[model samples]
Target chain A: MSWLIDPFADFVFMQRALLGCIAISLGATPVGVFLLLRRMSLTGDAMAHAILPGAAVGYLVAGLNLGAMTIGGVVAGLIVAVLTGAVARFTALREDASLAAFYLISLALGVLLVSLKGSNVDLMHVLFGTVLALDDAALTLLCAITTFTLVALAMVFRPLVLECADPRFLASVSRWSGPVHFLFLGLVVLNLVAGFQALGTLMAVGIMILPAAAARFWANSIGGMLAVAATVVAVSSVAGLLASFHAGLPSGPAIILAAGTLYLLSLAFGPSGSLAARYWPRAHLEA
Target chain B: MALRIRDLTLGYDRHPAVHHLDLDLAPGSLTAVVGPNGAGKSTLLKGLTGELAPLEGCIDRGVARLAYLPQLSEVDRSFPIAVGAFVAMGLWHRVGAFGRVGGQDAARVAEALAAVGLTGFDKRPISALSGGQVQRVMFARLLLQDADLILLDEPFTALDIKTAADLLAVVQRWHGQGRTVLAVLHDIEAVRRHFPETLLLAREKVAHGATDTVLTAENLFRARQMSEAFDDTANVCVRPATRGAA
Candidate 1:
């Protein structure tokens, strides 16, 4: 019990880090669930990579200011999203092709920008994260983002579900689909930008996606998926932070690996999951 | 409310799928838009439902509220939703996006599920449902819509005969209620059986009027011919004879 409770109780930084991770999970996992439901998992990954240049530019301009980097990352990600959508819409290219093209170009630009301005230590920090070192400003930002995200998510949940379920049906019935879609995309960008503070761009997607993917193996409804995803994120974050402190491991990778491990375990052992469904009587389609 | 179309050319990617169509759907009118494959039935349906904008002309949707049921294939059955919740989505128009679904809304959802013969399936995830059951759930949603006009596209394409007949009864019930209904259907005999008015369409309108008058053997032959040679740029449609109001 001491081993479990000592790290959070003794260190204020650890407590803040734990809260930060939980906040990111609460916001990011639901967005992650929607991304998976819409078959846009790769799109999330692409957007993550695309945010690098913008954050790097922010670092060059302001030297790791959380607000600047967040705005830059969001702008970069939005540009990629919009450009991908536009190319797919106007040109003969499909969405996947357009996304791949735009993300690759943006990724290259990000690498170039970061290398040009930041040192190797700064580069490592940007690529990984500094969760255990969250100051007051960073914690406040994370909490505010989480609050907005949860409220916006509650507002959009129904329309967003309908949008994901059958966009054409929603379009026929009401004029709400397009706004709901842009807002959903906006939430994704916001979560990634906020997650960037603690998890870094590359690992933020892991925090967003892995828990949601694991939850799918366990839950039967969207609301259940969201709840289960948040739980998985909480467990993963706490376990990963404790392991990092005790075993002298990297915090970001440890958290993601913890999530990945849970995903594998759920895949095998979840009651209605793939492996269990295979060995048992029920079909996986019930999920 | 009536739906009026004038010289509507609707399509995708600059190619006109439905070219130069003029039509009128009076308030409370029930008409079937029937045609062969690639005959622009879906394009026209999409245009009427306001899903597709006219590429060349205009449509006056006299009603602000309408409902549309796309083909079953258009919906993702893999979504993790229950039959009851899916039907409840139709109540969004009344309850709003963030509004709570109270006992009244829940009762309506139950009545709709019961109407479609899906009683006591409130919590069953939709992915486990059969194709016909999924179609029924779509009908249940449509029932909850309570719109002034309804547009259905290929509603019975893959459904079994029983499911088709049962769902068609809902269409008849809507007609009985004096709500306008426009459906894009493939079964010609079924169209003649139930729909009082029919519009036989090729890339162009072949005939439009009473089901018995429009679905003639010659008009059916012309429709099939137009579908076969649809890409011919030199194609000039020459109606054998103009049916009334065509």
Candidate 2:
């Protein structure tokens, strides 16, 4: 208990970091559940990479400014999303192909920009993240983004579900299909950009997708999945932060590893498609 | 007429699936679009529902309210939605995405569910439902839609006869209410039994009139003939470019 309380008590940075990661978990995991259910996990990964070039450009222009990097990441993500949509619609390439192409290009450009201007330490910080040293602006941004995302999700909840459940029916009934789709995509980009500031682009995706995939094993409804995913993410965040502090591990990778652990645990034990059900089929059948 | 399509050329990738078509679906009538596989039956319904855009000409949707139940295969059945919640989606027009589904709305859903023989299935997850149960659920949703024009694509395909009959009763109820129902079906016997009118299409309008007249041996033979011609290499219908821009 002292070990748990002391780290947070001794350091304001730890408190801020916890708040930031928790905020992200609360907002991003729900969005991640929607992505998983929509089969857009790879899209989330694409957007995460797509944010890199923009953040790198921001880092080059403003030198570690939170506002600049966030704006850059968001713009970059939106551009990739739009380009993917256009290419998929107007060309022979499927959406996944177009998205993969754009993400690869975006990632390459991001690495090039970082290598060209920034030092190795700066690159390390950008790639791996510094959750322990999140500034006032970063914490505030994370909280603001969480609030915005949760509110937007609530507003678009019904149409988003309809759009996912039966797109053609939604299209025939109302003209909100395009708006609902683009709005959901916008939420994905915004959440990924918000997450990258604390978790790094690579590890932020881990916090989202792994928790979401794990949650699906336990629940089938959106509300239940969202709750389960948020819980998994919050626990993973705590475990990662503790590991980073106590064992001298890097925070982002540690957090992702924690999430991966939860995913594995879920795959083995969670009710829906768990190993328990697979091996003990008769009990499940009786139930 | 509930829907009027004039010289409509519906297709994908610039190749027409239903070409040079003129159709007027009468108000308050039951019409079946029966065609062999790939005879543009689905394309024609999609055109009416505004899912597919016509490459040439246009469709005048005379009815303001329209409802559609797409093919079962097209719906992501594994989506995390419950029967009651899904059935409530029919009120989207009135509720506008954000509006609450109040007590009256709940009653409507319950009534709709009862009409389609899906009572007490409110909390059941759609994925847990069998194909027949899912079809019943879709029909209940269609009932709740209260649309002036209802389009159903393979509404009874793969459904057991009892389930089909139960769902068909709902369609009949809608037709009895003087609402126009356009259905795409493969069952000629069901069409002749229930649907008073039929449009037999084979890449073109083979016949369109009374069900018995349209489903005649001669008309079906013509439709089959047209479809077989499609198998040959010389399947393209050519014109002298009369409609090109000046």
Candidate 3:
């Protein structure tokens, strides 16, 4: 039992890891809600995979400066958005097909760049994540990104959700949905790039989407969903940190697994509207 | 002023759905566009509402402000939005970015809800509402928009008799208040009983004028018969009204 507190107490690194987890979780959850509501979850997945090549390019060009790398990643994300939009407009192909094409190509390009640089280990760290290895710079970047993400969401909460909930109304009134959508995509890209040093490509997106998806099972209002999603994200981040410390596992995967566990729990036993709500109608009566 | 369309042509991606069609909407009147299933009724509404650009010609005295309600079946209802929040969307044009919902906005939302006979359902989740109830919520939203011209596409689809009657009453109320309404409907009797004007469309305008003159057997037969000039995929078929059934 003391061993639990021992890891936390013995090292500043552990404390930083926990903080980093909180930051990434905070930044990504509401973002996930937007992505899910827009039916862009698959697009989010593609963006995550596509960031690998950009990260490699950034690393090669700027030699691990977090800002430069993030810029590179965001540029890649915008390219994905533009390419997907263009393909959908010009061809008979759908958005998903375009995303699949872009991401798969990006994955190949990322591998090739890493091989060219002869930095296989660093490349693995970028892909799989290295949150435990995060220095002071990465920590600062995560904090700043989290702050910016939350503030932007606060500023545009209504229009963003309004656009998703009823685009026809926006169109009738001449509100441009494209810029808002692109801005959202840009923020998601930033969060992905900022979180990569800590959670890696796969885990960062998983953390963003899974907790929000779980939150959907529990709430019927935007505020309620946002609150629930943020809480689930915070709780799962802590659990993942503790589990990773004790069991000698990678922090990112452990955090994702923790979030996945919460999702399953939400799926199974969350109150009235949850999956548990479906099987146990009598259980719902009490809530 | 009357609404006028001058030789308007429209299409999706250069494939013309409405070809050199002209129309005039009399102010303060209710007009129903009755047609076969593919008769370009929706396209006409889209063209009128400025959603689809006219490939040729232009609109004159098109409503300075317009409200459009899409088919109930066309909307995705899974979003977790409240009735009040849904109606509040109409006030987007009035509010500034990042502005809080003030007393006035809230009042407007409440008034819109009351107008639709749903005054107490401000907090009700949209997904929880019945089909007719949902349509009423949309009507409330349109009320909040308060546009001079209202275009509804198949607003009565899947509704019961009472709900449809209640909805038509709401439309009549709008017309009484001097708002112009162009509603796309499939029921011929709903048109005859409720609306004073009608437009019959089949890729092109088959008839446009008084409901009785437009709903004649000759025009009905022409509307049902597919256009021979265009290929099957290129032609827009408006479904013939199942007359007097409603």
TM-scores across all candidates?
A: 0.93, 0.94, 0.91
* Top-down lDDT ranking: 1, 2, 3
Stretches of candidate 3 exceeding 4 Å from the true structure? A1-6, A283-287, B12-16, B72-74, B226-229, B232-246
lDDT of 3 by residue, B21-111 (tens): 7777878988999888767788888888777888776777656788889763334577888889888988766774566778988999998
Model 2 lDDT tens row, B1-246: 788877788887677788888788889999999888888888888888777888887788898898888774456888988899988888877798889899999999999899888889999889989989988888888887889999889999888989999889888988899999999999889999999999899988888889998899999988887643333344566643323221
Chain B only, TM-score of each candidate: 0.91, 0.91, 0.86
Cand. 2 Cα-lDDT: 0.86
lDDT of 1 by residue, A1-287 (tens): 99899999999988999999998888889999999999988778888888999899999999978888878998998888888877887999998999899999999999999999868999888888899888888888888888998899888888899888888777766778878877877788888888878988889999888998998989889989998898899999999999999999999999999999999999988866569777875643653
lDDT of 3 by residue, A1-287 (tens): 77767777888888888888888878888899888877787777788888888887888897766767777787887788778777876999987898799889987897788778856677777877887777888888899988999999888777787778877666567565666766787788888887787888777788778988888888888888889999998888878888888888888898889889999988888763786678776632442
Model 2 bad stretches (over 4 Å): A282-287, B228-246
Model 1 lDDT, residue B67, Cα: 85
Per-model CA lDDT versus the true structure? 0.86, 0.86, 0.81
Q: Which of the predicted structures, 2 or 3, would earn the higher lDDT when compared with the native?
A: 2
Interface RMSD of 2: 1.4
Candidate 1's error at B3, in angstroms? 2.8
